[model samples]
Target chain A: MSVLDRRRGEIGLGDVASALRSLRPADADDVASIAGVLGFGLRAADLNAQPAPTPAIYDHQRPLTPQRPQQTPSHERLPGWAMPPLLPAPEPLPDDVLPSQIFRESPLAGGGEERPAWLGEAYRLLPQERATPLRHALLPARTARGVLVAALATWRTGSEIDVTELTRLLAEQRMPQRLPSLPVATLERGCQLLLDFSDSMVPWWEDLRELAQQAIAVLGDDLVSAYEFAGTPAEAQRWDVERERLVAWRPEAERPILVATDFGIRGTPSLRHGGAEWRAFVARCVSVGAPLLFFVPWSRGYWPSHLGLHPQIVHWHPATSAAMLRRQRGLSRRVAR
Target chain B: MSHYTPRNFTLPADYCFRGDPRDPAESAADPYIFSREAVIAVDVALATGRPLLVAGPPGCGKSRLAETMAAVLRWNFVYQTITSRTRLEQLTVEVDHLRRLNDAHLAARSTSPHALADRDEEYYHPGIFWWAFDAHSARRRGLPESVARPRSEPRFPGVERKPPDEAREGTVLLLDEIDKAEPDLPNDLLEPLDRGSFGLPDGRTLRAQDGAQRLTVITTNRERELPPAFVRRCVTLLLAEPAREALVAIAAVRAPQAEKTLVEKVADRIEALRQELDESGRRPPGTSEFLDAVNTCQQLRIAVDSPDWEETWQQIELVTLRKPMVTEDERSRPA
Candidate 1:
């Protein structure tokens, strides 16, 4: 016989009787079937011989009556063997107990708030050395002499026909003549400059950073705001003009953002989405009537073709020489003014 | 310079020539919304007789501006799409070498004494710019008309026909997507574009007749930076994205059958999606995509704000809004 058969043999008639009593079978056939399954000799009368004890009466005013046993809903009911023992409920805390008390008792009480690993690493990787201050004299003008000449020429001849004047002449009996006048032009405006500190701009990092410092120093308060941009714009603070040091950056926005970078939007994974973001940024600037300029080391090599051309964006490049740098500075000064 | 008047000309039936300078209905059935700056730039370019260099995003009506100008002014239109392989010669004239050789062989074999063999003008096929130049000159001299009507009939059915007249004078040369060509192409165009003339390899000169300056319109997507020298010679215009109201006006003409409410809904959805895509660093859907969605919805007879509208839109958006490569991943994600 197998182990199962030996175990069944070990269970006596008394054990079978106790099991049948606990089951509380309703029918005589059920009682007989339970006894037969357990290999015990039993009749319906044998189960009836020992009935369960009754409960004591507690209330004198009411007649002694047995409470009907609670019935388990069919859907919620589980087999007796499958049901697990219920766990003890947790004790409620006293009203006097404060949250701070609990916190103080915990191991992490003194640990402070947790930060992501990457953010901490980024902070660590931030540049510590102060950039060399670019000389203001070495910086170039904002707009070229040729561009200025062209602007002047356009101003002189590029004007709308005086339609009202023409109509007045026609109404009177005189030949309508073409009369042109220059439109009101804003020569100076406050501008913002963005310095690129992204990984792609590492090659010209020092030069661009120094240029930004130089611009701020020369333009003084005319430069509305200066920012350091990687994936997004962050305002540079703690400006030590003499020492040429920018201590920290916080997120900010200013109009007419002149960015100094390689214009490499394809550098990082985040920049894969940079094209759309950059375009939207530019569109926002345009909507607000702000000029967005891109200052690059080499305009031909660094400029993104995908951005297309924009009148708002004045791409100043190839400022490798002191003369060119001075020209760019002059241009920036003009724009800032 | 005198303003060239179009004689015996009739506007296309589909086009509504309102004659109002403020309204662009004279250009096409749909009115073009030119920004005040763009208008000034165009006027300046016309006055100076310089090529107007328009730089803008792809499909932002850079090329269409030239076509509209041609249609509005009743000038003969000539367009050339530049590619990486486009050569200077292709822009001027294409020499039929094989045909020339065949003509030479035929001339040599001919026994007739009267037969003369010469590198005739027949061997030279004029390019787009050449055609524009020749047409303008032809119109000026009152010579035989070389301009031919488009072979394809009007695409719009049941459109009324307008009265025909004598061929119009002058030509509008549209050099589209010039940035797609080599960087040197723009630089090469400087001399011809400024002088209104270029020389052929066969020692013949092709020059615009006096007082008949061809209106040259050059469009760039900024795929390449144009030479500063080239830029300096031309009047420049930068076309930006239109406002929502402007877009709605544009839609009224482009998709006349689409319901106003439907167009507004589509445009709003497109604008929202564009912003979301831009923020998330994805390629935002363009004006063309929005128009396509509106057209598809109209054709499919999908009613707006119906019980199944949301469900239907979810399906339609897959084909229209989602980029091809990103569609599968976008589908699997929860809406």
Candidate 2:
């Protein structure tokens, strides 16, 4: 017998079934060749038969629910069968797996409730202390001005002449010319201000909060929305520029969001537990296309962790001085615009 | 001479066009897929006669946009790649001090006064902006001057000049990677950019001719913060990272010989890898890396569906995407 014939004869029904399962025939010729190699009389019914679906090692769909492990003989060996050893059953997920549940219990997750007693008492004792009115420092606007004088200058003469130079005959018929107004560059978008009010930021909390309030006031209440993030984000009341008092705000996703944070707390238990919460907030920020701006305190020397090194984050050091913070915030607002 | 209309002109063979539809033979191939916002930004920049300041991540086609626009408009193109030491005067006119010194020495030895006067003009070499402005003038005057003017003289002794026919219709000045220059450069650009003119050291002003305003395209990788006053003068466009479908299309264009499935797989893997890197706080690979990997795969002739393909892909990825010294803190974090 020929080598091809011998090889064809060696092919069994099992081999044909395996080949049919794996091969995706491009055309009728490929299908015929595959069938011919098997040395079997190919029937339409055999080709049409659907292969049994392989059992999944891990059930990812219902992650929390336990699944029964698959049973296969430990030492059963089949010809040409190549598969990895069956994986052990997956472990059950932790009870506090959800971020929302963890966030509710964490002291770092700020609201009026979980904060220090002193902070709450201070707010109650001090009659709604208004933030100081910000003095706007105006920088000189740089303008480019020049005379566009050209040699062999073409001037249309009848009643109109565009001439920078005046000669004898040219001066006689020279008419006053009004150049076309130059186009003004306009900013089409506004920014949303996101403030970080986590527990680690206790020292700079009042100053940063006041800065955020001033930013909102300067940018106009309608143009900006203030957000405070501790364990999760909350819409903070902004100080209205017109009224000169704190006013309520609603979160809007349309404007460009600029997140302000110190990113100081890295190793605290609450922060460690709130990792998922941080990720979710980041994902939401990314989904909404928000740009983060880090407001670092100079003395703390705190660096952002891996979670804080997101591509969207921009860093700014706002030291104790409120003037510097206001300047940086104003610059950021301009840059965003 | 007839006025050159961009709508009617065709891109010539010699020009080395960089991005999308890169194959010269495939004339109908549409390589670039521009977003609606990008198109609108370009339209606005053109309409207002403002320089388009395109800021984006490296290798995301900020510089390529200039070449693409020039090709689309069928205009004359000039590129100035900015570096740290690039002087402000180099943008307009560079006086050859050594040449002037040599010429002065020769004039002092010679008897003719005309030679000394003739050499003064020779010392002042025209820069890229001058070329663009002059080319615009040549077009307006209906002169037989080449659409793209050749440099007056070589920067150094034996450098050969490019062939003349390479010049096309009008001018598009591409100030590529402007952020690489000194902090003051962008601010210095504001005056010339706003006036559409600048004065040479010799007191002669190089201005844009009457009708046409030379299109200026400035690209920045955002390495440093540009002055706000300078940024305010130009129309800005931020090119965000492209979506998966756009990236796949870009990959296919970059490696035309590779199978569609193979290109898609590479693009998907690249996207996933980028995400992984971003999460790990490592600098992620951009479009250039994706292109390099796809090109390498095509050159190696690796079959996408074969068992060996995965191993080959991993090897290629090491060179292209893998950064040395991934942070230990990132690796230890829970998934």
Candidate 3:
């Protein structure tokens, strides 16, 4: 598996599979192969060595010009001159002789199956559906949980390594003034899950709940601060675990915020979540150094243009994965020039 | 460029991956049966310098291949299971700032002679890459012989997975579940894996002393896509799910104590269950589940044509093969 072999996605099977060379017929007898491919039935030469021989389909085929099989339609067919003439016009009977127009009954009328009494309700009622775990889900719960973890989780410095202060101390030969910094990927700073519960998001209400659960599952129950808001995300209120009451969502420095919203796509104009509010929320998060991620149910084209580039937006879809998220965030390695 | 075969790297026909005995006495499984394709893949990876990327559904024996290779070769094994939080620095080298600070404090106090004699090299914590590349250098923590070694030795990954007390030929490094890490991790790994060296913060390079003897085997559940660049640097192998015949053969090796009839029955059931699950868009049970079913039947004295066969098999199927991901909302769904 050399670099070029992998790069081109081809292997040199010809070098190893000697049987392939044996497949070639002796003395350039490739006409059979070509004939077979071209749908030309085998010639007498192809079956020369066979003990039992069968005629090819073409050998049994009849001519396109009139032949025995087709002679009936070609010769016995009726001509225009020999065809029967049109029927004479029917004579109209006297008014008294025929039954009155209104009195004559239509034979087709009143001949039908009786509509059953229960049929109406049956038509109105839906069929009893069996439960399915995967049907109509934004993503598989397991993969969703992983993606949520990958997208929302932020890294914090480990307690150990404070290289700058250490370097200063080592150079200047002074007492320690700061803690050492050993940066380890962690969710210690926690995350704020802002779920959109507005009218537009009604269809995905269950999905919103699932998303909340996924976020909490990834970033522990204690660390995740979930909030619910209708129109504007910035005006969200969360049930504060400490206060035992709902509190307005405030950006905490170093804490990441994950928003799962549709940007009020299907709601009334008045109920739509304003882009300005999202922009403000993102601005506030940026000001406080809180990372923000938006998991939108809509495709990129349907997303609001005004949200700006600050909040990383992810497609809330089953196909959306950590690799796609990395590409979006410009975190993946430099791929192509 | 030479032709490699099973003859070059054949396991002792009885080499199986059995579970360790617990407090309660339980019958052990038979030897692991090696697939020809898997063996060929290992040989190719060994011949080539590129890392071997093994991918399959869970318990399809992805990681076991690496361990088997390690055991066969009698190499130093170092493995690391990746999580969402795994980073490139964790796999390479990291500076111990606290230790450096402690050393500085002790040197100032003039009480600890160990701290006084310590150099910048003593503060470096060599990660698995350093250990696999050159154990001697990692042991010394990149310090010269004149400098005293660090008080604590660097920790090696997969110490338990390493075969016990044998002359080591080379290293077999296993990075298990690289897919579990964030997407950037694969990309971050490309340079270090390509060069077999990683850069230190103090502008020094820790590299592989001898490249040919070392084998890097990375496994994935394919939970997510890895960077193409990272994949390009690997000899990729996708282990196909085994067939009915394969299942039976695996059972023969994995559950040697079980009767052939019993193993065949379980294999037949597994084959049916695999089709059923695949048709339903669910992941089918792999070899581990197969062994569990056969072992369960053997221990409980369940025969192929036993009384209440259907009912007993149904119960076993529910516990072993059928693992449906049912949410509370979907609990009422018909199976």
On TM-score, the leading prediction is: 3
> If you assessed candidate 3 against the hidden native complex, which CAPRI class would it receive?
incorrect
DockQ in order: 0.01, 0.02, 0.06
DockQ, structure candidate 1: 0.01
- Grade the docking of candidate 2: incorrect
Off by over 4 Å in 1: A1-132, A135-337, B1-31, B106-117, B136-168, B329-335
* Weakest lDDT window of 10 consecutive positions for candidate 1 chain B: B152-161
Error of 3 at B53 (Å): 0.5
Highest-scoring model, lDDT:
3
True contacts kept of 1: 0.00
CA shift at B286, candidate 3, in angstroms?
A: 1.4
Q: Name the best candidate (by DockQ).
A: 3
TM-score for the A chain of candidate 3: 0.51
Ranking by DockQ: 3, 2, 1
Q: Which lDDT tens digits does candidate 3 get at residues B4-103?
A: 2333345544434443332113222224566644655565555445577887778888887777676666566788898777778878887776667677
Task: Supply candidate 2's per-residue lDDT for A27.
Answer: 54
A1-337: candidate 1 lDDT, tens digit per residue: 3423312113345645664555444566545544543334442111111011111101112232223123244345322111112234458888796555333454555447676587756455567698877644212443332232121111112233455765677688786344433242221233465666555665665455445444432222333345555544332233322222333432233334566665555434333435775676666665665555666554454455555444233344333343444465457547656
